[model samples]
Target chain A: AQSVSQHNHHVILSEAASLELGCNYSYGGTVNLFWYVQYPGQHLQLLLKYFSGDPLVKGIKGFEAEFIKSKFSFNLRKPSVQWSDTAEYFCAVTPSAGKSTFGDGTTLTVKP
Target chain B: GAGVSQSPSNKVTEKGKDVELRCDPISGHTALYWYRQRLGQGLEFLIYFQGNSAPDKSGLPSDRFSAERTGESVSTLTIQRTQQEDSAVYLCASSAEQGTKNIQYFGAGTRLSVL
Candidate 1:
């Protein structure tokens, strides 16, 4: 079965700090990757996605992710994270002809 | 609706009782998916509905769980003889279609508690 692994369960940082959330998936086929964020009281929303084209994709707010095909990773990165960025981030991956699989999720806490 | 909408928002039922959760996908969406999120856990895929047919239901834990969709708009997930372990948030998502339009829009979710 395909699975996504998010190494960190939680991360804490002060405002303006750089952030990186690690995500790796176990699919060997042509895959599509995505990053979804869920705010404290809001539903899960798309942060970014990678289907094809550039390996580096930018998303809503100031979030961005790099799709490293060789490493099977799509890590989310932010140069300066704010308190408003505090939320649970999920990494999802789906094969070209398969259902999507989500990681356990990483809770990011940005302190002011 | 403008976005995916799930009914009840919260449901509490006793063990052995049956509970039905409803999901109204965004208009024009042809793909609907159901997931379960246990406390401190990731989203667990439950079922997928393409139009009115469920092509993939491999994530259903057991026979106690079943889901059906009405055409391509609404879907209902039913839990029979609910167990305490069934307590979790049921989420519904819909997307326009496969391929380049696979980005899914999620709902607020229905939090189910089986005591």
Candidate 2:
């Protein structure tokens, strides 16, 4: 079974601050990675995904993630965050033939 | 007409009663999935249906939890003799294909409260 690990449970930052959320997964085969975000009362939305392109994948709202196979990590990053960026973020991975596995999630609070 | 849809946005049931949750996938989609989101917990895979073939029920937590899909349109997840622990947000998502790379469109979810 594949497992996902998120290094931080909650993160607080002021506006315009750089952000990085660590994510690691345990899977040896070909895998697809994704980051999803959920606002306080909204449905989960895809932030970004890595299928077969470059290691660094960019997503909506100025979010990006880098896939490092050797480290088994796909960490999410943003150069500067806004107050509206406060939300809960989840990292998920899916093997070629299995269902997607998600990390516990990291809550980001960007204060103005 | 746009995304996956789930019925009964909220449900409250007695511990010993049975409850059924419904999901309507987007038109033309061939793959549908069911997931559970407990409070403060990540989404847990429950089941997956690919077209008219037998569904992948490997992620179902226990025998008490079962799901069914009709054709390629609607799916129903049934909880037999629901318990308090069964309370959670049941989410439904659908994709165009069976591969892991396909993007999944999710519904707002059905919040089930088993008391």
Candidate 3:
């Protein structure tokens, strides 16, 4: 069974601090990657997605992820985060079949 | 219509009782999916519906769980004799089609508590 691993469970940082959330999936076949974010009381929204193209993909709200096929990792990164960026981030992957497998999720708290 | 909508935002049921959760996908969505999110855990895939194809039951945790989708419009997930372990938020999502590139829009979710 394919699975996603998110190493960071929770992370606290001050405003303007750089952020990186590690995500790795265990699937040998071709796959699509996505990053979804949920605010305090909002539904999960797509932040970014990677189907096929350049390894680097940019998402909404100043976020970007690099898909490293060799490492089987697609980590979310932001050069600087704002206080409003506080939310739960989830990494998900799906093969051509369309069933997505998600990681445990990483809770990011950006303090001002 | 605008987005995926789930009925009975919160459901409280006693153990051994059966409960039904509903989901209304977008107007023209061709794919619908159900997922369970336990507290502090990632979303677990439950069942999937794509157009007229037979629904995928591979992700269902047990036989007591079943889901039905009328065409590509609405879906209902039924839990028979629910247990405390079944306590979790049930989320519904819909996409344009059954493929990796299609983006899925999610609903607020139905919080189910089996007492």
Candidate 4:
């Protein structure tokens, strides 16, 4: 069975600070990666996804992720974050079988 | 008509009771999945149904938890004997098919509270 691991449980940053959330998976075959965010009182929304082609994928709300096959990692990044960016972020992966696996999630708090 | 819909937005049941959560996938979607999300936790895959295939039940937590999907439409997740630990949000999502590129549409989810 494939599994996903998130390096951070909670992250606190000031406004305009750069952000990077690590995500790693344990799949040996080709995989699809995704980043989803859940704002307070909101449903989980897709941030970005890596299916194939380019290793760097950009998503909504100025978020992006780079897929590194050799490292088995797809980390989410933001050059600068705003207070409105505070939310819970989740990294998910789907193996060739189409079964999706999600990491534990990381709670990001951006202070003004 | 826009996205997946789940009924009984919130359910409160006592321990040892049975609870049934319903999920209505997007129109024409051939694949539906059930997932559990405990408080402050990530989604835990439960079951996946594609058209009429046997259904991938590898993620079901236990025998007490079973789900059934009629054709390619409505799906029901039943907990035979609920426990306090079963308190969580049951989320339902639908995709076009079993592929890596298909984007999944998720419902608001049914919050289950076992007291």
Candidate 5:
């Protein structure tokens, strides 16, 4: 069984502040990583995904995540966040195209 | 339709009653998934269907929870004798095929409240 962990439960930041949310997973084999965001009442939407190749994967809405195999981590980051970026973010992991296991999620609150 | 669709966007049921949740995947999609999102909890995998093959029910919490998918189209998740603990947002998602790289588009979800 694969497990994902998100260190930050809630994050509060001012507009234009840099952001980083830590995510770690326990899976030795090949895995696909994803970051999904749920704004207020909207459905969960993909932020970015990593299948292979470059460790740094850029996603929608100026968000990016870096996959570090050795560290077993794929952390989401954004240079500057806006008020619109306030939402709940989730990190999901799938081993070899199987079902995904998601982290508890991190709630981001960007104050304007 | 354009994306995965879940019926009864909000369901209020009594404890000990059975409730069925429906999911209609996007046209032509071969893979569909059901997940539960409890308040402040992560998305919990429930069941997954890939074409006409047997569904992967490994993620189902207990025997009381079961799901069925008709071919590659609609799916129904049934909770027998629902309990208060079963209350949560049941989400449905679908992808192009069975692969990790494929993107899964999610529906707004069916919020089930057992009171």
Candidate 6:
């Protein structure tokens, strides 16, 4: 079985402030990691994903995440966040494809 | 539509009643999944199908929860004798690949409210 843990429950930041959200997963086999975001009253959409190659992966809206294999972590980062970035983020781990286990999610509130 | 679609964006029902939520996957997507999201909570896996066959259903909370897919396209999640605990947003996602990593496109989700 696989599981995901998000270190933070809620995060607040001012516009242009740097941001980082921590995620860790536990799985015995090959791992694929993903980050999804849900804006206020919007559907959940893909942020980024990491499967192989470079540990650093970038996604839409200037968001990025680094896959640290040794740490069992895929943390999302943004150098400068905007008010529109306010949303809830979820981290998921898939041992294969299709089926995934998700974390509890972290709510991000970016103040303008 | 270009993305996954869930019918009846919002549904309200009385406790002990029955409700059915529908999901229409992408045109050719072979992998479909169901998840539950409560207020201020993350998505909880419920079930998944690969080509109309359910291979993973360990996430279903209990016997009251059941789901099925047909023609490798549409899927329906049925809750028998719904409880207040069943009140949540039921999300559906679809992916094209079966074994490799692929982006799972999500639907707007059906909000199930039990009164």
DockQ of each: 0.70, 0.81, 0.84, 0.69, 0.82, 0.69
Better of 3 and 6 by TM-score: 3
Q: Which ten residues in a row have the lowest lDDT in candidate 3 chain A?
A: A95-104
Q: Candidate 6: lDDT of A102?
A: 91
lDDT tens digits, residue span A1-112, model 6:
7789999999999999999999999886788999999999988899999989999999999999999888899999999999999999999998863468899999999999
Off by over 4 Å in 3: none
DockQ of candidate 3 (2 decimals) = 0.84
Q: Please, what are the lDDT tens digits per residue for candidate 5 over residues B5-115?
A: 899999999999999999999999998999999999999999988887888999899999999988888999999999999999999999996767768899999999999
Error of 2 at A87 (Å): 1.1
lDDT of 1 by residue, A1-112 (tens): 8899999999999999999999999988899999999999999999999989999999999899999999999999999999999999999998988889999999999999
Encode model 5's per-residue lDDT on A42-78: one tens digit a residue. Answer: 9898999999999999998899999999999999999
Docking class of 5: high
**Candidate 3's residue-wise lDDT over B18-114, tens digit each?**
9999999999999999999999999999998888999888889999999999987889999999999999999999999567787889999999999
User: Local error of candidate 6 at A96, Å?
Assistant: 3.3
For model 5, the stretches where C-alpha displacement exceeds 4 angstroms are none
TM-score of chain B of 1: 0.95
lDDT, model 1, position A44:
99
Error of 6 at A10 (Å): 0.9
Model number with the top DockQ: 3
Model 6 clashing residue pairs (backbone): none
lDDT of 6 by residue, B41-106 (tens): 889999988884645898999999999898788999999999999999999999998765967899
TM-score of each: 0.98, 0.97, 0.98, 0.96, 0.98, 0.96
- What interface RMSD do all candidates show, one decimal each? 1.6, 0.9, 1.1, 1.2, 1.2, 2.0
lDDT of 1 by residue, B36-104 (tens): 999999999999988756458998999999998988878999999999999999999999986534999
RMSD (Cα, Å) for all candidates, in order, is 1.0, 0.9, 0.8, 1.2, 0.9, 1.3
- How does candidate 6 score on lDDT? 0.92
